[model samples]
Target: IPFGFYLFLKTENYIVGWIATLLTGLMVLYAVYTKSLAAWVSISVEAIVFISILIYLVKTGKYQFKIKSRLYALVLTFTGFLLLINIDSGGFNLKFGGLSDQVTSVQEFVQSKSSSGVDVVRSDAAVKGQSSIEWRWSVWLNSMAMIKDNPLIGVGAGNYKIEYPLYNHKVVRDTKFNLESQLDRAHNDYIQAAAEFGITGFVIALWAVVCFYYILFCLFKSDLSDLPGKKLLLAAALMSAGTGMLFNAGFSFPFQRAIPPFIVMLIFAIACVMHAQKIKTSHTSIIDTRLLYAVTFVFTLLFFYIGHYHYTMIKADKYFGRTIRCYNNGNWPQLLNEADKALSYNAGRKRVLFYKGFASNELGKIKESIQYYEELIQYFPNYINGLLNLGIAYGKVGENAKAVETFKKIIVLMPDEGGYYSDAGHYLTKLGKLDQAYTYLKKGAELEKENAIILLNFGVLCMQMKKYSEARKVLKKVAELEPDWDQPKQYLKYIKEQT
Candidate 1:
């Protein structure tokens, strides 16, 4: 579509170009209003670039305004006015509001978290109130930290998820703020590139963008009296696409995905086609049959390799999906089988290892489960699920010391998590360390006041310590929190009998 549009522009079809621009501009405006902040920023950059090029052509007398061009121009003008009115009415305020909110959030975060390093932008308020903003900012901060730590050669491509927890801010850990999803991408392509490929990779990417615009500029300056309108329109479209990519990279990991990169490659291909046409008309050269054949063969081999890689990835994904279904259905044997199949296709998949560990635990293969969890933790030390399950496995195998230590480590990794404290306290209670148990239980209660389970446990602990009054109060609160629960009432009854 982009190539065809470019060709239309180069053929002096100003009507087509103007109509296409208007339609695309309207779509982009709608996306900005309805979609994410990154969408707004990206499309806005494209619009700016497109408009700038249009103005430049007008100033240079390259673009001659015709009667038909004015019709599309009027439509585009009306559309712009409509969008502007919508913006004024607060329909697309998220773009501006989100930015202002972020600034305020950051200021509040810094003021409250004075002790935390600048590398760590952790704030309980930000995490609780503006979770999305906080999450993105946190990821960016961690990515920058990663870049600083490995400026020459990054952590490695596709290894950000593995390395993220190591750079997780202490405030996030202390608050036990659980993100709804995994932080796979840094959410900024430039930062991700720097973190994955180091400073050299980042510079190379910048150089590519510079070269793209430089080529466009040269093309724009070329004599196009034969089809001046076509050249001007094509230049504007190309400039719009390039500028969009530049802005998108600053705030989005578009290169990590397929579609955005594909669009970019398509634009580049169109530019190459235009350049080739220019060369063909200007200079005649003898064809090198041997070079042509060699190029074809090399491309053939490259395509074959790409096909095989994608095939393997698809098989891996299929098996992984099957494994998840089995796990969800509690089919331990099927889960293990599917996980094994996935590993055969894509060895050392972290999630597959997790499933293997879980299935082993369910199958009563305690030793095997422990081994699997240990292996997983070796690769993903900060994986909460692996650590949590490993601790449970240890407890099941009568390795109380290991279990206690594992829970303690979980507390350190997620200090503000009441559940870890509660788990540790439960283990301490089993070990008859009443004082230690009380301390942890109390801390857990303080952190998660609304947790009925923690409150019930604390109440029971108080009873064990022979603090009758404390037990009564805690038990009463649990009863009130869970009105219809029989356990809290039974505990309250026991406390009454004791009194």
Candidate 2:
């Protein structure tokens, strides 16, 4: 009966279970981290849990079922009620989640880097994905559709961006708005796998997880001291990771993070190995030293393989560092050389392609730059930097329509502010979409009313649209804002001549 009870307890206390319990608290804490009072209940609940665990460990000299747990539970319940009161009183923007709001700062940083020619090439994908309620819905649907088309083998690893647009017609029927344009990635792991590796790779990955859990189960069944406690902790950690995965497909760079999963995997793998060896020793009639030597040899080989994987990635990172130095120093040829070296180790990396494209563009290798941009977009379609550069490359080839369409995508993805809108407006005006151009220019001017450049652009757009009175109004504002600014004076001259 005790054994049965333990099994039931074990099943209920699985890693996923602990994660679910903690996720609400994590979300609440994330909000709190960003200074939102809406997370007070979550914070209180987390505090209660933390304190309860500490008290139980301290008072009972046992790991479970203590006064501390009861106290925490009580605090959590009380905090949840208080949370309702806080939200009702504060009119929060539900669409603007804490994660999305954070992206604006990142977007500003990326823009600044781009302007300073930092060669960092930070992606706007996250910012675009966060800001666009519409694009997210479209991309999610399109990604699933791509998965459905190639359910078994998938399109291939790193192929989802290339396949994204091909699957778009099913989700987005209209071509007028350029919604059918392929996103670079599914922007999701499950979807990316489904589109790239097919169901086979995904299932293999799933099987790996299942096998890992089975091994963990075996560990719990053994006579390891603190087995239950470790299981509970591992389960909690796994749950948190799994929860994060569900929302983002591991796009937050888990595979790159050196801690957390690696430590957790090592712990679990060690426990399983130890438990298996103990079980075999208990049941075996005889053991061969030769067999032991063979097993050790195999382990050594496996260790080398894992080490090589990490070493290659590290080497790639090192080469990228060199590329950054070259870019910073304005040595275009050296930047290209570093990019080539980086790609020799990790060809699938998008940032490498971004630099290659940027360097090629600067060197007047227009065709070569376009190829790199195309490759980047094919690999990472949702990546905003790639999209922007690809458009610029196309513009260099006299594909203004393609450029205009690409810029429109940027405008749709990023919030209409700063020069992003103004640049689009300027290009749209060049394309003779005077009315559309004026609207964007006006919006950009409103976002930065004090800016002499935006004000002058607005004045020029108004002149083109034949809104003479509006042109004069904007030009006069610009002149007042910056008397010495030449563009506003030139625009004022042109407007007076038209009049």
Candidate 3:
């Protein structure tokens, strides 16, 4: 609808303009009613850009803002305000469930993360459920830290995940939410760009935006009376698109996604086509009919190849999904079979390697699992789960030193994670490196105070070091934290008997 209105203004077609305006109104109303945050924000920004252009045109005496356009703009502005109110009112669920529920959900989320020793804002649990917002914040924070360190050229494109855990915030690592999962994107395009391309890339991106606006301004100022209102309309539409990109980038990595970038290119292409049509005279011959037919044939062949590639990708994805379900169910043989099928369709599928490794491990093929993990790591060295499982496989094969080294590497990759610390400490203790084990265990306990397992491990380590008082205190805290867990109580009694 936004684009259609631009086209209407450019062509001076009243029927197209009114229809586009009505559809745009309906879309805004729907976005408001559905409480789609992204849609609301983008649409509101687009409306503001359009209205700003209209105001500029009227004030500069270049064009008149008709009463109809004024009404549309006013309604759009009103809808935008309503959306803002809904957002401020916590999704406006108070009328249905009372404000107390919303308030309590926020309180619980805050308390959960705060008590877990993470000083981060927790989103409304009623809306976001558990931990996702915190996770995204962690990713953003880590990405920002990385940007500070590698401000010039970033860690490189497609390398965010490789650098993510290395720069992960301490609070994020110790939060005990989806600790096994790896974060691939920062969820903010601008931040992602800085992390991937560095300061140079960021400056380039800024320059592009500046250039876009400059071009738009030039178009607006162009004397195109022969084209009649085309320049103003085109400028407004492009401005709206630019505004949408700016706002959307704050919360989404849209540049990494397919459809958003495609739509952007399509819009530019349309603008070019329109401009070309306006400049072309009756005698203009851009291309001969034979050349046009040849170009059409080449494009058709290219599209066919692309379509076939995507079709195969879809099939491989289906097999991959089946593999995941089998893995979740502990059906190793079925998982392996499905994963093999997926790989057959797409040999470069890295996710399939993870599943294959996991399935091999479950089937007690430790060597095969190690091989799979090694291959997976060759492709994506920073894969957290692959590193973790590979370490376990090494331990199973009695490669204690290699296992300890692997765990240490994990610690370097994710320094704040209590699990990695505990694992490394446990392996060290097994290898009779009690002093090193104690150091890691103590740090793990400090970072993961509420973790019953880590606390229990730390208490045991105290007992091993013959510090009866420390053992008693640690065990008592664990018991208090997990009242129903019998293990801490058992350990506490054992410590008391030793004392």
lDDT of each prediction vs. the true structure?
Answer: 0.75, 0.61, 0.74
Model 2, C-alpha of 331: deviation from truth (Å) = 1.6
User: How much lDDT does candidate 3 score?
Assistant: 0.74
The estimated TM-scores of all candidates read 0.74, 0.51, 0.76
Give one clash count per candidate, in the order shown: 1, 8, 0
Give the worst 10-residue stretch by lDDT in candidate 1. 170-179
Q: 278-319 in candidate 3: lDDT tens per residue? A: 454566666688989999999999999999999889989999
Candidate 2 ranges with C-alpha deviation above 4 Å: 1-256, 265-308, 490-499
Q: Identify the runs in model 1 with alpha carbons over 4 angstroms from their true place.
A: 1-26, 29-34, 67-126, 170-180, 221-229, 269-305, 428-442, 455-499
What is the alpha-carbon lDDT for the whole of candidate 1? 0.75
Q: Weakest 10 consecutive residues, lDDT, candidate 2?
A: 1-10
Best by TM-score: 3
* Candidate 3 local lDDT, residue 329: 92
For model 2, name the residue pairs that clash.
Answer: 15-235, 153-198, 154-198, 156-196, 183-381, 184-380, 184-381, 184-382
Which model, 1 or 2, shows the larger lDDT?
1
Please report how far candidate 3 places residue 119 from its true position, in Å. Answer: 11
